[model samples]
Target: MSQHHISEVPVEQREIGMLAKHREHIIDQIDELVKRTKYLELLNECQRHGLLSPGMCQNIKEYTPGRRNENEEDLLLERHRQLFKKLTQRGPRAYETIISVLESLDCKEAANVLLSVDSGSFVSLREANKSRRPGMTVVDEGVTTEGLVLSKVSKESKYQYLNPNEPLVPYTKPVQNSKRIVKKSDKCHEDAVTGTYPMCSQYNRGVLFMVNIIDFPNPGVIRNGAFKDGEELIHLFREIGFTIFPYINLNKEQYMRILKELTSSQYVENTECFVMVLMTHGNRVNQIDRAEFHDGSIAMVQTEIIAHFQASNCRKLANKPKILMFPFCRGPEPDKGVETDGRSAASPKPTAQPKRNIPTLSDSLVCYASTEGFETLRDPDTGSWYIQKFCDVMAEYAHNTSFEDILKKTQSLVQNMRTATGHLQTGNYKNIGFNKKLYFNPGFYK
Candidate 1:
């Protein structure tokens, strides 16, 4: 062979005019093949052959073992022969006419003819080849046996075929991230105490209520001393101006009632934000006690109770910052401690069962004591790692920083503490994002 060095063309500016022209030509050929008159004639022929109207052909030309290299002309001719044989044997006038029409087109014209005819009918010729029978091949004039035409049918075309799901255009716009501003009417009160109140109300100056659900009925004298640490948390929130509501040994119904009242629009509307603290024994999915307990447990407050409140009454809080501090074990036991460690041994059974019906809140922050599939640890002397750090960070940062900033500080503190104590597994839960921005002043400065 003579040495033939072909010049490589830049794909971006390569000559596609020929391809475009060929495409247009093929399209025109298809247009002529699918003329209404031709379709009517085919339909008449099919009717004469005792066949119904000539419906759209789903798989006209397919690549097979022997037909892999077949061009449009060859395929069209093959289809004509197949249809003719079937029509003659079955007596479908429409099939006979369609075969005759298809036979008249050459390879270069066959694709356009079929496309135009189907385009006129309810069938879309541009739809994905997957929708057609397997082995079906779509080719342009220049498309070789190895080349394939990717067809995509529009919804409008599908609708013409009686597909209700298909539409001419997308009914919904693309979802885009947009900034949201959270509005509040309250101002921080100078008389409010520090370190106890949630920072959300400091900037907004709203009434705050802190509810602590402690399931401990009675701890041994030594354990009892440590359990009293939770009482300090209660006192802190109260001194900071929050109305303290402690639900001790509360059942499902009682918990629901309290949550209903707290989240009710009637009450929540008067406040700039809401804060809920759940301190109880929990497993991976449920909150349980020694005996039987509520299926959803503390989480029910958001999903079932709060959902009810928001849906029926408290639409105002729908967009407000609803903060939930969940300090509970979420999963199986932690690893055994080293001999050098002097901490108490792990309990035989989990302290509590998982809450089954916990609900998800749309516009809120859920601060878990531990990450998913991990257990939450309590100091017995300082409450839970999550709660202590959370309260401490809020008290330290509430006066000068935003709620978002406080969360960041809390997360850092928890990570540091976990690392320092050799409990690297005790890291903070993932940050719960919000759709809107929230700013808070803890009232420590004011």
Candidate 2:
């Protein structure tokens, strides 16, 4: 793409035009030195009020004769310098005008220079410098003839007082560097998505609980790659707006106790949602078992786990969203080899299942790594296939997209990935028991 000269574009359209281009979007970033918008108006006011002499105004007007790119930038820098000088002198109605012009030009550095040299900060110093003792000379104290006061000099005898924060020199405008626009990673898209809704800073959003098991007493049952999965999930959830509570290497009894406490009214108060991330090893006995603690070997029922957080059981979370993610293997059966022709078949479109009339689990969304009796795939370098896809999809499209839509995309993406052994793996979303369609406020967070 060809680079456009700054002088060719109108001031207002500069940002918009740069954003419209696909390749040069980073050029729309705020410039260090902002060009003055009301240069003629300020010049006219200074000349009429005699704040600046006619000769000084004429010199400013004739600083640069041409509208070339280099010359225009140079003229803008000079105007900023003149404005800073006038601001120091405390000209009538000049502070408001200069501040407004700097804000309009998006000149943050120049604005800082103006605000740093505040009028109020100089009043005391100016008065002190003008007040001198009648008989106190440099030779009277242990001071030199160059007006350098000694440390023993009294506060009243000091000639000059300067605020260290304010500098006498004008701030030099920095040249714009070609900073590479950082794109979101393939495995995790943190801030890639853009939307119109403002981010709600009230922080009424809920809490997230990550239950990870990395160490097991039995050396044979080592969860090598599970720790990375939990770390990534914590970072991802926290970024989108969830207060994270990481529970690592907990036994069965401790897990239940924590869950019970979280479901209570005191813990769940003022929370909009709850997220439970479980990463551990499981067996055919229908329970997650990995570590051996003081309270025997860890073994907890999956059905009972979800049932404990039901609306009837946990009244505080009634009518609120509860997300449950399980990234561990459900069974020991790995995907076996299969021979087939290189032909693809069209899959049927997904349809929403009809709501049940009987009493059922409510206000909960549960996800599993694989279907029943199948083993899930995990990459040693990256995390599980299901979790990586789920996080990436949620990060990029969760702002405006529904939670169900994000899950559907994650499912399709995970299903298309093949394991290192040429085995296909798929994730299952079971027990989606919410009454209405659920959506996350990814647009708002802490």
Candidate 3:
């Protein structure tokens, strides 16, 4: 390990080459450098010096929260690791630029932290041939008959889906070498940026409670392609690290029970976010926002649905993102097609701190497939335009963009969408209690 010291490194390899080899050491010292430096300011200084590329900046920004875990001690270690990895991939002057940037930012300790790494040392490798676990395979449709006694019907059933809450091989000890290897670990800002909520991938990512209503008793229209929407949604959110619990054709009692279970579940307690997606027929009755259940009973969106995750009722989800998506009608009318006079489409992003004393419903977002008084259009073969777009945008941009911005993009796509009759359907949302930004950080930990 002593042979890898920075003092013994060749001058030519000092900053650039040694960076790649010594990255683990750099990560090892993360707790130190971050203890003395302002991480974002470091990024800014690096960018200002033309040392960090825009893509790198966006990647780091998206991976690390803008606000959460910002304290000196609890600093995000991966942020520095990512920056170092990018720097190593850079050209000749990468070393001088970062060192200068560190000095300019009054982060001499951070600079020294880099310069002090023992580059000659290499971490021990994990056993290349460890016993394989019985892993369950995930498919696009989400329903799998593989991996267990029940799966004897198919070759895919040889393994079982591992529950994360359950300990994996209880006798196996976790590998704990900070100076082992450079671990692997997105974009920002055409729109206004806000403070990002901390999304920890160390444990649970988030919980998704989805109810897809395709069947209703009596004269109600059986929502065609609704299951497609639900299937797509389940697939999409699982990528976001959500523990998906999906229900189909639930009556009012069962729907209410789902809500009750979610609110009272231990999963929400440690989750970074809680999302509820409802695909069913809905309409405004006496100015109340309501949607139909399997039995055709109406659910009060605000009181019954949103109220469940409010800080007052579910304290466990307090200060966390509670995203409620209603891909259904809110009123009886459709948004008539509007002729835009012209087609078109930058500001320096502003970073704002989340204000205190917000509201009982803080940290929640409500997404409506169509604006009030408009009918949400759905395709018999596909699904609703709003939800399909929502899935698409999130899949493409959630890595580097804020959830709010993703929603905005989804809405923008929905606004121009015309039904078969040439009527416009616009997606809208209520941004309640969101003073900060939210990044999905898809597949970061995995």
Candidate 4:
């Protein structure tokens, strides 16, 4: 009972302390393993019920308590089956309890403590969580009762807010290509008895006409410069199949008579598609010439031209495309004025008015030389900028693309050329209402 016996007692006490610590560690490990097993089982039950995503199954498999050994896997499977059956009977409350326990431990601490017992299952669990629930909120991961409640509540609330009587604001007008004015007229005379005129039948082929009135004297003269490019334009269209009609030297009466004759019972009766190319000087609303004045003047043609064509007698051209190419300077006044602070305060002025005098063709295309009110430029050598581009593009792409495509390409090319090369710009004012595509291919192959 001397020094040896005393050292033996201390050693025994140390061994007891070590055993107690190891037992506590084992208890903690068992608790986490049991919690994870329940979580996996609950998730599997949810999958069977179609409540859980496929991702949950993979996550649970990784966290399951097991090894490659048959006995351990069997034990893990039994635990999973038991827990799943319990969850199916008791519902999500059992799973919620397990999640609450897991949340109490720091995620990294829990992984470290759990990893040593069965590395394979723990690794799988970690991988599943990393893939499916990385940075996911409780609500997004659907791991808690509160999260599930929120998901259901949100869906129900959305259904309650469904509305049927909301007012609709159209993003764009439906009657884009059809002239609103024409539709108004048709609506006005819906019940009227009208005789139909077959203009194309009376005429052998479609009538293509161009009216250019360049040299007008005095206040009667709407455009100031010399005949810029009207003749050039006429020639371009002529090459494309237009029957050139020079109205440049005609007096007021003569011009009116020619238009009337064209719109008369005999001429319009047989015309298939009517094209009028007008090149003249124009203000915002009127086309001016020597000695005579016409209001609502579009080029040299009066507004009545469209109204005349819409007449019941001119049914042959009904729904047929009517193409009008007008190259003229339009608007009230040029945008020029004084500056302030010794700096030019002027912004680039608008090129033209938004309104164009284009007829609705459902069968038609109206290519304006400039935007609404901007002055169209004419090269003393080449003619009007827009007319030149229009003629060029139409001649080139008429057979290759649809009329709409041609117009779009023409608009883009003309705008680019004008902005790059000239101060004045041109644009096509398109309002298409054609039932069928117009193929201007007569001169393409020739």
Candidates' C-alpha lDDT: 0.38, 0.48, 0.58, 0.39
The TM-score that candidate 4 achieves is 0.41
Q: What tens-digit string does per-residue lDDT give for candidate 3 at 298-362?
A: 66888888787767778888888888888777654546566677864444675655556746787
Query: What range of 10 consecutive residues in model 1 has the weakest lDDT sum?
Result: 137-146
Best candidate according to lDDT: 3
Which pairs clash inside model 2? none
Q: In terms of TM-score, which candidate is stronger, 3 or 4? A: 3
**In model 2, which runs have C-alpha deviations exceeding 4 angstroms?**
1-201, 286-296, 337-360
Model 4, 283: alpha-carbon shift in Å?
Answer: 1.1
Task: Please give the distance, in angstroms, between residue 62's alpha carbon in candidate 3 and its true position after superposition.
Answer: 49
| Candidates 1 and 2 compared by TM-score, better number | 2
Q: Candidate 1 vs candidate 2: which has greater lDDT?
A: 2
Candidate 4 per-residue C-alpha lDDT over 213-303 given as tens digits, one digit per residue, 9 for 90 to 100 = 4433221122222233444444444444444444443444554556555645354455555676665544343232111222212223335
Model 1's alpha-carbon lDDT is 0.38
Q: Which lDDT tens digits does candidate 2 get at residues 323-425?
A: 7876655543444446779898998875766654534566677887676655565543344567767776766666555666678777777666553334555
Please list the Cα RMSD from the true structure of every candidate, rounded to 1 decimal place: 29.2, 30.1, 27.3, 35.4
lDDT for 63 (candidate 1): 18
* Model 4 global lDDT (CA atoms, 0 to 1): 0.39
User: In candidate 1, how many Å is residue 126 off?
Assistant: 82
Model 4: ten consecutive residues of lowest lDDT = 8-17
